[model samples]
Target: MIAKRLVIAGVGIAAVLGGTAVVLDQVTAGQSADSRSAPVAGSSPTASGSGADPGTADAATAAEAGGAATAEATGAAAKPAEGSASAPAGREVLPAVSPSPSGLPMPPPPAPLISLPLPATASAQGKIVDGFPADVIAFPEGTVVVSTGVSSAEGSLQISADAIAASSQASVVGHFQQILGPLKFWSEPVQAAEGQQSMRFSRGNDSVTLTTSTTGTGSTRFMLLANLHAAAGG
Candidate 1:
């Protein structure tokens, strides 16, 4: 009986050791499987971390590429628009300026009028017979006045006229001939209607008048006048 009890105890001890070895083997196999599955889970497509989807990453990359392409196209299109905006509009364009013509001659200006006042002098040929007051002699080419004060034989002599027509014709003729030799004078009498004389002389539009009258003793007196309407260019 003692031998059987000892044998039974030894079998119980062997069974317990077998069960412990089986449990340890199973535990080691489970650890190896967990280690293998951990690597697989890390490498698997569906096991991506951070909730990131592969399709979503591809879509984002495509979207970024598309946006870059669109931006490049937009930049290209905007270049011409920016260039056109910087250019002038139709109304803002300036017309071409023409240069002045070379060597063109200008017209001559008109003449200027003249006015001269002369000093008094005596007549060398005549005595103080019938003298008058201040004389105004307007030359054919200019407006000149020869004013003489009241006269005795020794004092200065004055001459009077109704306009310039009653002045001494010989003095006027001599004066004009000396001053205006370039002018053309009428040689014949210029007659108006009703036997009125309208003498005309000109030096570039200058003119003159002449008239004669008989005194009571058959003495004749002549008057001369000039219109200096054209001496305006001097």
Candidate 2:
């Protein structure tokens, strides 16, 4: 009886082994078929992993890996380096300009220019003398009176004047003519020689003699001698 039970057990084990072999073959065949058809359908590789064939699952895994690699490469290409320069977009940038200094000190002004005559007295350097007939003889504007004198002798007034004018000889002569003409002073013919002139005028008891000469700097130097006698009274 022991021998019979042993034989029966052996047959049962053989049947189980045969069934397992058949199941393994079917699985391998289905996998081969899926692999052949996977490329045609183009969708099986993306399916879920639970019930997929081994070949399909392996292909899906490879596809996912390749996609991940492609994504990684794209991201790397898109990203910029840590210190790399960026692309310029709109207007060009220019360098900044610095302003010039404005607070520097200025130089001092120059001294005034004064032309003084030689032999000028201290009291009459640039002013008219007292007791001189100012209304009858109008000195030109800006005339510098260098010397002046007033004296009385024999009940008559005598005045002497020396002055300088920044004017031409002709201009000074014209000025005196204009002044004495209106006062009915008869003027003698002028004596002129090489930038020198002498003029004499007489009205009633008053007589004026003027001598003018041109200086080297285009100025006129003049000397005046006048005598005035008091008019007759009732």
Candidate 3:
């Protein structure tokens, strides 16, 4: 009885071991087949993680990572450059300052131009003199008479000539003094050359002036002024 029992138990043990081996072989075969059919690394990913193959999930993960990297690259390319973002659109940048061509600082603008005024063509007093004691001075013969008119109204007269003689000037002065003779005519001293003289004489309501000066070529210039005020209530 003991021997039979031992033989049966041994057979049962063998059967169990054989079945376990077969089960293990089948599981290994199934795993190999699944591996062969599984998605490769770097393939598209699945939406779901549950029950997903590690290889497939890994491929999906790698693909996602690569896509993110590619997206980053593309965005970097599209983004504006550092200075471009700050620059104004459609406008060119100009230099803040321009240098002088001479390389020195630009000269201050030229000082405002100014000019002196010239005298008018005609004399200011309008040649107002007359009855000039030609006896006092006379122009040299043939001296060009550029102008030959004297003007007077009331008690004033002026005369001018382009050329004259000093001797004639002295003679005329002596004659005038002799003719004026001593009538209480108050006189005002006036500066004059040796042969030329100016005097103003006043007597109550009457006054007279004898004035003279000479310029280039001894052009004789003289003025005579006389005022005989009406006697009181006359």
Candidate 4:
């Protein structure tokens, strides 16, 4: 009975030691797992930290990618407006015009008429002492005569002729008679030269002495004569 009691006490002491060893091993394993799972206070984890979650890291990476893409799109949208603002302003374009020529049409000139010269014979013998060739006479037979005379204040008359022809007396006398009406003369024809004639006429106190002669022939022939003191003081 004493030996059986001692054996039972030793078995009890062995079972208690085994159980304590098992409990110590379990506590050590739990301490190792806790150290691996928990982060240290006030310490940042590295990229390779065992405490970091893969899912959380992937979500952070996706957020960063989305931010970059948004930035790029914003820049693209603003690029066109910036480019247009920096460009130059537009202008209205027009073509250049030139001047016209100065050359144009103009007007024409005028016509010229015939004029006769004054005589010198009357100026030498008259009181007024100035004379001009008055009328030019032409005959159908081609003769021309230029008459020259002088008149005094006392109604004295001196007449002379520049005969263009010795013939053509009738042609010269006819033309002289035709112009006589305009000269305001009344006269009877009197022979003065071999082929010439003279006429005398008067108006008021004034007297006229005329001498006519032939010159040239045909249409170029004419007669010239003088009427002096026909108009008083004229």
Candidate 5:
């Protein structure tokens, strides 16, 4: 007989195994779990693993899967679900695989983030992006605002700034930092071109992304993205 113990995220106390629904006790972040059940006894044993009866094979498979889950739920990085019984107890839970309407596994929720890499750089001699300027600069054409347009259901706010001039990636980023004081940078601006770079910044749920590029027309382009919804920890 095999006893199955499982560790899971808060409010996620069960799992689907071999078409069977197995319920485990709720576990707190970093807490031990209590969920064990002996597998169904199989038919007469065979020569080896290859000849094991279907029941025995199923049991062994489930046991291995359960063990892996236990390891994940017991990790230090596990976050607790909100409003759970363990909330007051300082227990965290990690997101777990959820079943979709088709009975298939759904992807876990996205973690909060600030930004990603830069978009393509076009013409440097173009109109200026408005409403979000870290500082004033001389651009032959002007600056325009743009964003990567991250998708979100809760809606989002965008504040962008762009420029069309000659400027180094570092200088543009430095200027933005001056305007957005008290901001926390998540990643350094990675230069995609001699005059183009992208970086991520955050303050709680608020996020600021800076992207700069040079257009083929001898222009410098800069954009600043500020999303309030994302800042709220989307």
Candidate 6:
């Protein structure tokens, strides 16, 4: 009977040992599964704890893109616009020019001057030249002839007389104009000297020029020059 009791005890003990080994194997498998699911060292964790979060990744990408866009906009704003010009700093700006008036009339330009060479003839104080055109161009009244010359060559006659009159410049110039106006003599443009007056008359290849100036004696000194076609007059 004692042997039989001993065998039963041994069977019970073996069964308990086998049950404990099975329990230990189950616990070891659970711990290995937990270790596998946990995050590695120095690695970031996500919401699911398995991988990265899609929403958070998208937000980061969007923030980076927005920052780049803002930087580009700021850089563009710093540059100058197209078709615009800018002067340097601390420089002066010139004033805009205005157009001239369109209504008023402008004065005519002054006429060109005429110059003549002096004659080499000795003349008396009161006698006229031999070939002077006395009928066509008369001298001023009471003119005391100082010098006179006449030249007839090259189909043209030229006479020059220098004289003094006890009259004003206006009187001497008017005397010739009154006498020559009836003969179709028109006035030409001339430039006179200071304190002096001059006139030129033109008709049919003929010209008469007179220059009169004031003398210290309150009298007028005058010079007369005539150029005429030789066939026209003496």
Instruction: Point out the worst 10-residue segment of candidate 5 by lDDT.
Output: 131-140
Off by over 4 Å in 4: 1-130, 136-159, 165-167, 191-196, 204-227, 230-234
lDDT for each residue of candidate 5 in 98-118, tens digit (9 for 90 to 100):
876766686543443323332
By TM-score, the candidates rank as 6, 2, 5, 4, 1, 3
Candidate 3 residue lDDT tens string, 1-234: 999999999999999999999999999999999987776664444523265766777788899999999999999998888766345788978767966587668543322111123111232232212433343334344333333333333333333433233434445444446655454445675776676677766555455566666656655554454543222211
TM-score of each: 0.26, 0.44, 0.26, 0.29, 0.31, 0.45
Taking the tens digit of each residue's C-alpha lDDT, what string does model 6 give over 29-132?
A: 99999998887765566535747775776688899999999999999998899987766999977877999888979554322111223233334456886546
Q: Candidate 1 lDDT, tens digit per residue, 103-165?
A: 869655435333333223333222221233222333333223232222222222233332232
Global Cα RMSD, each model: 16.3, 22.3, 21.6, 26.3, 42.1, 13.6
Task: Give one clash count per candidate, in the order shown.
Answer: 8, 0, 5, 15, 18, 0
By lDDT: ranked, best first: 6, 2, 3, 4, 5, 1
Best-matching candidate per TM-score: 6
Q: After superposition, how far is residue 98 of candidate 2 from its true place, in Å?
A: 99
The candidate 3 region of ten consecutive residues with least summed lDDT is: 111-120
Model 4, 1-234: lDDT tens per residue? Answer: 899999999999999999999999999999999998787765447534756666677789999999999999999986776434343457654556787878886533211111223233453321122442234222334323443344433333444444354454555555556765554545576567675567655433333445554434432223233444423434
lDDT of 1: 0.48
Give Cα-based local distance difference scores for all models: 0.48, 0.75, 0.53, 0.51, 0.50, 0.77
Show the lowest summed lDDT stretch of 10 residues, model 1: 148-157
The number of the candidate with the highest lDDT is: 6
> Candidate 4's C-alpha lDDT?
0.51
In candidate 4 the C-alpha lDDT for residue 101 amounts to 75
